[model samples]
Target: MVSVAEDVAIVAFEQTPSHAHFNDSEPAMIMPCVNSVIEQVGMDRHDIDFTIAGSCDYLSGMPFAFVMNIDAVGAWPPVYESHVEMDGAWALFEGFVRLQSGDIDTVLVSGSGKCSPGSYREGFSLQTDPYVHAPIGLDPRTQAGFQAQALIAAGKATERDFAEVVARSHANAKDNPYAQLSGDLSVDELLAEPYVQQPLRRLDCPPTSDGAAAMIIARADKARELCDNPVWIRAIDHRIDSHHPTLRDLTDSPSVRIAADRVGLHDGPVDIAELTVTYSPEEIILRDALGLNGETSVNPSGGPLTGSPFMAVGLTRVIELARAIRNGDGGRGVAHASSGPALQQNLLCVLEGDG
Candidate 1:
């Protein structure tokens, strides 16, 4: 495992519901979450030594848009803050690293975005290679279709398997109040639906959503004082693969494998795993990469397939798994986050609750 000078734990977390159209500014959506997490930890805003956020400027159709989001965290107090052009999960990664310095005691982390007003597919195409993928409009959905086809061609999975993932995700989402889509869906019923991208049906994709999530993390000693049931962060590691899809094995995620190894994911029995299965086929790839078995409850919060708030989706996975561990649903769990196209980048966070 990655050794640390001092242990860190997530003391509190909050998230807004995934909305099809929030009809408001990004700050408006994020403020509530920030307030709720601060309240949960019973701390004043100034008590947080650092604050960081993650978001995409391309999605908002404005440059330096993340600066305006500071309104949600408040700037009048001149807080030490930072921003990442990636997902909020990356912000959490930075926050975790900052606490390791021992100079800072606490960090407030958040991620928010509004995909409703923008062309979700077109906006994300910018994340692709400008010399090839972007010009051809090879968006995430198209790439996901390619992944699904690769899975079938390799005989690793079938359409039925993809449908089953969707069916299970929607079913599990029923218990998640923040999920945008949830219901009883049969695998056969899902397979019958027309394909949005060949081999991948409509149900196999995530709904475009706008939402926000925030959390408070502190050093081990401060965490105990902040909350009665602190979820400890065991280890965090991230890795990336090639940007070109052709250079990679679509059916597998080597980055996830490396991160899992670095985090010592299989060091002990894992009670749950919250993976960033934005596409149904990704669930299979992630499952195989993480080497998780039936004993582990996967995506109990429904995962991104039910409601993808882009920037916030990955961080929400951490919050969901932390919530489960805190509720005594599990003693230890893993939360996975992904960025770039078709899981080109992956982050893993191992969490455990005090016995």
Candidate 2:
């Protein structure tokens, strides 16, 4: 339970519009966001004390693919940098930890992905255990279908409930310019649609998207100098559970609950929560696990169900939370991210405006 030596806050954030095909390289997709955040704080690439990115090479069907993305952040001056194969939310976790050392005043964190070029079903199969699941080609959506089915069997939720979640997500997305899917739809209409997987329909899933997001975190001292409204990072905690889907209780997300506790989620009132609801059913599990009440605005920006860009989706959750706090939508909020099948791993970040 170590803590950061100095307070850190998100001073600026930026992201590219989610697109099915970006018509650009990963570096090109990431550069504008990187530039936007840096410009927001009136800093140059070299001015960033440390830079880290989160992305998956498997999506691009290549190794060391993240190396090329450094061009987006620039390397001419040789800055301290690193990369993670997970979502950018995890990269943000590292940046938060690095800032805790009190040696660096600023860090740039980013995540990006393009899912249009390859079969996500095939690409994601590699994440499964090679001996057991990979050989059988178990993908994320199929795993989610199992989770949705479990929720039904456990009587925790119903197909109508899934449709309702999708309906609400679309309604919320209408106002989100970055959202790829939006508009009003009825729950009955959604339920009548054919199922992509039993208990899950086409609308129950996130859109296949290509996108990138970046943010700047500054130490408390530097934060006051960086921006007028700095969304303070109150706490961040991430936990993982059994990776094998069969070993988990798909009806619940224990990792999320644990991370929430570690971050003191129940210690205060959460005004908003931006959850990574890639699968509509996930919202149910997350809401219950996080102990969120109806008063807590959930996914006001439509969440990943509107536009999911794989590695970038998790980080976008963090961006959304910061945006809410900055825009006077809320005073305090939580951002949640999940990786692996059926919420195998979860990260929770708590943020607050100036108190």
For all predicted structures, in order, the TM-scores are 0.99, 0.98
* lDDT (tens digit, per residue) of candidate 2 on 151-180: 999999999999889989889989998999
Q: How does each model score on lDDT?
A: 0.93, 0.92
Report the Cα RMSD per candidate: 0.8, 1.0
Query: Which residue runs of candidate 1 sit more than 4 Å off their true CA positions?
Result: none
Query: Counting only residues 3 or more apart in sequence or on different chains, how many pairs clash (N, Cα, C under 3 Å) in candidate 2?
Result: 0
Rate residue 210 of model 2 by lDDT: 96
User: Where is model 2 more than 4 Å wrong at Cα?
Assistant: none
**Clashing residue pairs in candidate 2, if any?**
none
Clashing pairs in 1: none
lDDT measured at residue 171 in model 2 versus the true structure, 0 to 100: 95
